[model samples]
Target chain A: MRALSGKVAIVGVAESDQIGRVPDKPAIMLHAEAARSALAEAGLTKDDVDGLFTAGISTTELGEYLGIQPKVTDNTSVGGSSFVIHVGHAATAIATGRCQVALVTHGESGRSRVGMPPRVTPPDSLRGQFEAPFGLPQPVGAYALACSRHMYEFGTTKEQLAEIAVATRKWAMLNPKAYLRDPITIEDVLNSRPICWPFNLLDCCLVTDAGGAFVMTSLERARDLRQHPIVVLGFGESHTHAMISQMPSYTSFAARQSGKVAFEMAGVTHDEIDLAMIYDSFTYTVLLSLEELGFCGKGEGGAFVSGQRTAPGGAFPMNTNGGGLSYTHPGMYGVFAVIEAVRQLRHDYLDQGIRQVPDASIALVHGTGGVLSSAGTAILARY
Target chain B: MSGYKKPLPKPDPVTAPFWESLKKHAMKIQRCNDTGKFFFYPRGLSPFTLSDNISWESVSGRGVVHAFTIVYQNRDPAFAEDVPYVVAIVELEEGVRLMSNLVGVEPDPGHVWIGMPVEIVYDDVTEEITLPRFRPVRAT
Candidate 1:
């Protein structure tokens, strides 16, 4: 457990100059812009970054685009959760001297599809053969299935689910950049038009153009950097199934395994989790993840999130960036979550004018990829 | 098929038997004889074991609605006309699960609930493929 704990730290984090719009830049251009900003923030130039990690594109392509010949590169695309796992990878790589500095970047043109290739699956693939035949719309279709089962098993009400959206909207209202900052009510959510039966348009996350990047280096090097280092205490990742049909249990997440490992390594419990930057591709994703991450008992997510507990001034502050529900959400929302966690820990979120959490020393940032099929958890603290 | 532009299952060598059985109006599941567990979406090896010794057997074609959703919109052009269609996962008595659609009932909050018993019905979409759907079982 001590092998990588506190050995590495995230020295800098940044987002593209333009987000929430179909940017003038291409996908690779976004990656470059974010990477350069992160480098500038860390007081390092391209030459200092020896490790490159990315998703939706190869690190080789990114290296060539950024003109950085990384000593180590990882292209671990596990959906939205890829970047958090990259931290664990970066920490281990730096500890082993594989690289001195690691830069992880994520950029997607979800709304504009600018320079992105069409996503196609062969007919015989797991998704094509079973899940696709029914013409299921993702990530809603797959997640709604799990929610329906959770409702059956636990009597989770649509009202309880709407509470999540309501709470998130309250947080969104505090952030000027949130795509939908207008305050929302549970009634409004219920009245919203349904995209998928169990999920209203409000329940689904916003589709926007965005990119985020961060740099990780050994703790020794981080002390000398201009930015305050957010120490990486623990990280864990797990996955059991890809397709919903193959998933062993609807209410469970592979995050249970990953969260346990992360918390144990960090030596922190739920009460000590100062801020939670959970991926909110949809409201259910947050609720289910809260339960899976051990914040609340299984089947108690509805009650746990009620009364806007995660909203401003609530007991727990989650998705302070307003989350994918209101904040700009590219195809992969994980990188943005990590960026927010870092900002909160640095007491730098005031740039958005939102009140900072009093004690942001310890944070739990959990990311889900592929419809809850994969989860990677990171425990970051400001040392 | 009402000019549906949604992707259809193109039965490959491994999954031909599953599609062929659907055409016969029968529900077939791959039973890993060694593990004594049933699996779906026809595969060569058991998910638990590497053993390819399997049997394709017909089940009762009756199961409980494990979960379901009514999709109001979709990405594909084939499903443009399929607004408010029901996508469901049914858990068969054989302990395996299959994803299909719900038929013969209204798709609404009051009508649909999890754990409702359902029986399989076939919708002959094309000459080669028959789409299996489920309807709520009438309390006998």
Candidate 2:
């Protein structure tokens, strides 16, 4: 596994206002806004973007509307982790000299918008439709099954899951851009109405109408830019299935296989990671990712998350931007994960009354798509 | 397989047999004709051979609990009445796992252990549908 160090860098990152409901705003507007913000952050305009990569948005329609003909464009929609996978792909493209600058963006009014055309339902050949009609229609319930299984197998109490929500809400309180900044507690998480067994309303992520984008450029190009470049050190990806039940192991994640590759490629160990931006579509996700990413041994995630390990100033500073659990989850959260990693590496929010991980150098960003179905991990470093 | 409602009419080609078998109080799994590999939650093709030579076979619906959980909360609104239910992933005799509710026993997590013997029992919730649930097999 070759390290991608110094081959490509995330030059800029930006996002749209995190709002609960933007009924009238088209999804494209959110994407365009984030795109413009990212270009500005990179000290470049839309004209400098030779490639466009988008997730959860209509690429052909958006590309036509943006009025910038891109030499390369990709619309890889792997659910929430689409943008993170795009970052890996864009890094490869930049390394191979296919495109100098690539923009990866995502936007969705998932809270307010309704009736978006279904992109790819699991094939009729899969058991998705059969199980879907049997009351497991979406990923939430599917993940709830895994949560229940986790609880049964490991004696993981509901309060333990609540700890993740409480920790994330505390971080959200300091993030002005976070959709839900109100302080929350384990009691709030426990008392909040249950959406599914083991998952309360607070345990679920915010359904925001937001967008986010990241601008990636070659290392040589980024070196000439004004701000410090966060280089893409390494990345790994794996996909099992779109349906949750198809996963081989309910307790273990396929992320270990990918995370191992990424870590090996980056030439860094888990101990060297200064910051981590794990995708938190649900509280259990973070717990599972922690175990899979080698933060703790297998089956020890239940006990590892106790004692505020993932909280601010803890052993690991994770999801510093509040994460999707408390901040904003506008359908595809992969873009926001990268955006926060870049910010943490750049030390951008230090003066915003937010607690910062001092001298943050290397950050790991992970994205899980489609009901624990696909995992993408990337290592970002500031040099 | 008599009590639960029939699943909403949808074209689930691969799992039609599994569902249709459940209606008859039986459990079926797909086995690859070429490689003799067994798979569950039915797929259109065999995972090992990638061949479409797959056929449904009935299982004894008897196995050990690979993993089990006593849910203090129920997921479906209809099952809300059945709180504190036990759902276990039973590894069937055919070497495939099925997620089904455990019945006919007190729901206690402490009393359960991995590799505990279990057997499937059909609950006739509705005339057309029989829900396959598991129960702890009593010690001989």
Candidate 3:
């Protein structure tokens, strides 16, 4: 099988004009605003975009709103990890000469709810028939259920999970755009109101308004773009059950399958990864991703994240942009994960201090979606 | 009664049998005829073999608490009044797992523990709907 490694490069990355709490702008406007800025950063125009990729929203509607007639389009909506998987799909399309310039964008009023469709689980659906009737309180309850099992099987502690929140909050303090900037400690997290058992209010991600986007093209054409091209080195995507009840094992996740393929295709060792952008819809998400991604041994995520190892200035730098826990998590957060990795690789915050991972050459960005159901991992490089 | 605000199971053709079984105070899950592996959330085909050779077999209404959580805040009107309830994943004696609520005990960490034995009890909420819930099993 031929590898898509080095075949595509991301040239531009940007967020909507305003990230947190823009109640006036609807989701589609956010998409247009981000696309405009991303295209300008790449020194390209809307006419130059031939491939449009988005999720959670209609592709045809976004295409008409953006005034772009793309030759190819993808509406692969697999929850939060949709955009990360789109990155891999775009690379494949470009490598096969299906399209030249691909635009991946995201916009959601997760908090404001303006122009957002009503969230529904129909009575006839599988979830409606089986899981929804139990009043699990979605996403959180599902995550909490898995966390309970993690604690049972591995003896993981709530204090250890608090360490992840503390570390990510530290990074959030450095980013001006992060939603929750105040510094918090383990005790503060532990003391926070309990939303669901095993998950305190502080452990949950903020629901805010935001939009993010990035532009990519063939590697040969990327060198001439406005910004340094960040190559799509290796990528992998996988999904397990949609319902938390049907999950094969609550303690393990599909990231193991996705991460292995990503690492193998990238041909890089664990130590070579300079930064990791694991989606943090919840603190346990990070700990589980760390273990499943081979950063640490299974049943050791609690110990691995102890003492703020993943915090800034620690042994490993992760979620430098605060992550969904502290930063803006507008429903789907995969695009923001890629946006942060691109910014770090380009040294966007080098002079600003603290948030940038010094000389960041390779980054592993992973996104978990749908109650820890789907995972998409991408290995990006700045060679 | 019109006052039961909680969400109820909406069964269709593929899943009507499971709900009908619950109305009779019994539990039946889809089992693959070939592999003898049982599956929950009844479906037409076997998840293991993807064959139409499936049967709705009666299963013991007994299981163990695989995992659980006590929800304190739920904004949905149907569930807001029922805060601090026990929502759990029960692994049945037949080896299939399903999400349900645990009753007959306080919704507290001290009262609930993983691997605790549980048995099913039917709640005939509406004329047409009967919800299946679990409770701690007493030692024989």
Candidate 4:
């Protein structure tokens, strides 16, 4: 396999025109808005783009909306991670000469629910037949089950899990665009209303309307662009189960495989990673991803994240964009994750003193989609 | 399937047999002849072997609760009336897992623990559909 290390560069990244709450705006408009912002940031126009990738809406629809006749397009909507996987796809597509100037976009009116199409998972489909009838609760309920099992198996504590939420909110305080910046404590998390057993309302990600976009091209082309190029070191994705029931193991899932592939492809180890922007759909997700990504040993996620280790002044800085817990969590957060990783690499945060990872050259971002059924990991480096 | 209050499975060709058997109050899962593996949520072929050499067979219908969660609230109206319910993953003797609600037991973390024995029981919620729920085996 051809190594993706430093082959392609992310020239520009941006979020939708407005996030948090745009009740009157449609989903497609957010897509177009983010796309225009990202393309302009790259000092390029839609006419210069030859490839487009996104989820929820068809690439053709997005292409038409953006008014670009793309020669290559992909709509791998596994969930939020779909866009993360697209980074690797676009990189390879550029490497293989499929297309240049690839644009990946995501926009969802999660809370506003305006101009969002109805999703119908066929009743006889894997989810509807096996999971729907069982009253297997949505994301929170399903993830709580995993957290409960992880605690039972590894002696993980709820307080240890609460540390993740507490630390992420601390990062949100530095981000002016963050949806929630109020300081919270472990007790606040525990006292929060219970959505599902083992998971308080604070333990879950926020529901908001948002969009994000990214532009990828060859390193040769990116150097001429206006912004510092964040290289795509390596990327990997995995899908094991659609429903949480078939997850094989609660504590371990696709993140294990995806992380391994990404690390090997990047030729980097966990010890060398300066920062990690992991998908924080739920607090348990951050904990388990840390463990599965080999940042820490199995069942040590609780101890690793304890004592504000990932907080502002902690040893390891993670989810500095506040994460889905406190950051804006549209339906799909993969693109937002990529956008944050790029911004951190470019020192784009307004308050770099608190938000930036000092001397942060290598960063890793991962996304979990479809109830932990699918996972994608990307290794980015600023040279 | 009419008059069903909750979401009902419109079984396709591959799953029609599974739902048909459920209507008769008999639970069946596909067993791969090659690998001798039993899997649930009936599929067209063995999930492991991916071969058509499969057979639907009956087992003890007894399983152990692998994990569980008590839902305080749900967005679906169908489950709004059933708040504070126990949704659990049960590992059957056949070595396959099934997601079902724990019946005949209260939804409490202190009360429910892993490895709790459970058995499948059919709940005829609609005329053409029968839901398979699990209860503590002792309560059966």
State the displacement of the C-alpha of residue A355, model 4, in Å, after optimal TM-score superposition: 1.7
Which model scores highest in DockQ?
3
Sorted by DockQ (best first), the order is 3, 1, 4, 2
Chain A TM-scores for all candidates read 0.98, 0.95, 0.99, 0.98
Model 1, residue A40: distance off in Å is 0.3
Off by over 4 Å in 2: A1-3, A118-125, B1-20, B33-35, B52-54, B63-90, B99-140
DockQ by candidate, in order: 0.78, 0.25, 0.84, 0.76
Error of 3 at A117 (Å): 0.8
Stronger candidate by DockQ (3 vs 4):
3
Clashes of 4: 0
| Chain A TM-score (model 3) | 0.99
The C-alpha stretches of model 4 lying farther than 4 A from their native spots are B1-4
> How many steric clashes between backbone atoms does each model show?
2, 7, 0, 0
Global lDDT scores for all candidate models: 0.88, 0.78, 0.92, 0.89
| Minimal lDDT window, size 10, model 4 chain A | A347-356
> A314-379, model 3: which lDDT tens digit per residue?
999999999999989988999999999999998888887777898999999999999999999999
Give the poorly placed runs of model 3, Cα more than 4 Å off: none
- Model 1, which residues run further than 4 Å from truth? A350-354, B1-4
Which candidate has the top score in TM-score? 3
Work out the TM-score per prediction: 0.97, 0.87, 0.99, 0.97
Error of 1 at A199 (Å): 1.1
| Clashing residue pairs found in predicted model 1 | B5-B78, B6-B78
For every candidate structure, what is the RMSD over all alpha carbons to the true structure, in angstroms? 1.6, 3.6, 0.9, 1.6
Docking category for candidate 2?
acceptable
Q: What is each candidate's fraction of native interface contacts (fnat)? A: 0.86, 0.13, 0.78, 0.75
